[model samples]
Target: MSSKFLFAALGLGFMLASCGNQKSEYDRFYEQDYKDSVSEAVANAPEPAPGTRTPSAPAQQQPAQEVHPGSKLIAGSDCTACHSNQQKLVGPAYVEVAAKYEENDKNREYLIGKILEGGAGVWGQVPMPPHPNLNKDDAGKMVDYILSLNN
Candidate 1:
């Protein structure tokens, strides 16, 4: 009888302990305190001139970053895992790709198809996975950005 009671207690304790660390919907990275702080800051801040930046506001409020438009797509996608601009990663460097193929109409069109369909045995054995949902125009933008990295 004592052994059975011990087993039940241990099981109950384990369940409670596991539940202690579980996060609910309200448990967000940006909590009420963070929202209050941002609201207070915005309320007090003086608006700057149309093109100018405010000195007291956060650094993120400064001039927009000089990153390419395709950079956002690259950041959200798995492209970073295999390709980097200046140096070799899992695949050839973007600069090397730019060197191999000029960014003219021919290469741009070809690369768009490659990016959408995926390719293997072209840049060695590591296969480039297909991005079926990525449209041709966006793929062209990414190709443009990669080609632009030749400098």
Candidate 2:
């Protein structure tokens, strides 16, 4: 083959190979579109404001003094084993629990029973075994601390 013809063929081969390896503009556009869809879905979802309860039910304001006493008991107990203030550990974070229950007084009572009698499937797949050792007062305190996280 002539040198010029050979060089032209080599250049064409290189161009084809590069085009084959590169992502198509359509592929890039779709990937970006998927990401934007997910971001928009999340942004449009309702998010509770900090220190405000979820709007499932209207929450009556409890006196801070009454909540403080129970919170102290919760801090002294074993509720901290599975629950933390900020993040999920063995179980969902106390902050998350508080956020879910904050709107309903009935939720507080129901959670108190769960604490004493242990339950499953409330937060996730993990089962939170009952803590029968905790008395009513202590359990009430833990619930208070859980609620206090909203503050």
| TM-scores of all candidate predictions against the true structure | 0.56, 0.50
Model 2 per-residue lDDT at 18: 51
lDDT over C-alpha atoms for residue 25 of model 2:
82
Relative to the unseen true structure, what is the Cα RMSD of model 2?
17.5
How many pairs of residues in model 1 come into backbone collision? 0
lDDT against the true structure, each candidate? 0.70, 0.66
Clashes of 2: 2
Q: What local lDDT does model 1 show for residue 122? A: 79
Over the stretch 1-151, how does candidate 2's per-residue lDDT look in tens digits?
Answer: 2344444455445445555456788756655555555555555655554433344422342455654666556546765566656768778887888778764678778988988998888778888888888887778777776777776
Instruction: Name the weakest run of 10 consecutive residues (lDDT summed) in model 2.
Output: 52-61
> lDDT: which candidate is best?
1
lDDT of 1 by residue, 3-86 (tens): 434444554454455455665555433344344545565555555543232455334322458767776676567887787665
Pairs that collide in candidate 1 are none
**In model 2, how large is the Cα lDDT of residue 122?**
74
- TM accuracy, model 1: 0.56
- How many angstroms is residue 55 displaced in model 2 relative to the true structure, after the best TM-score fit? 38
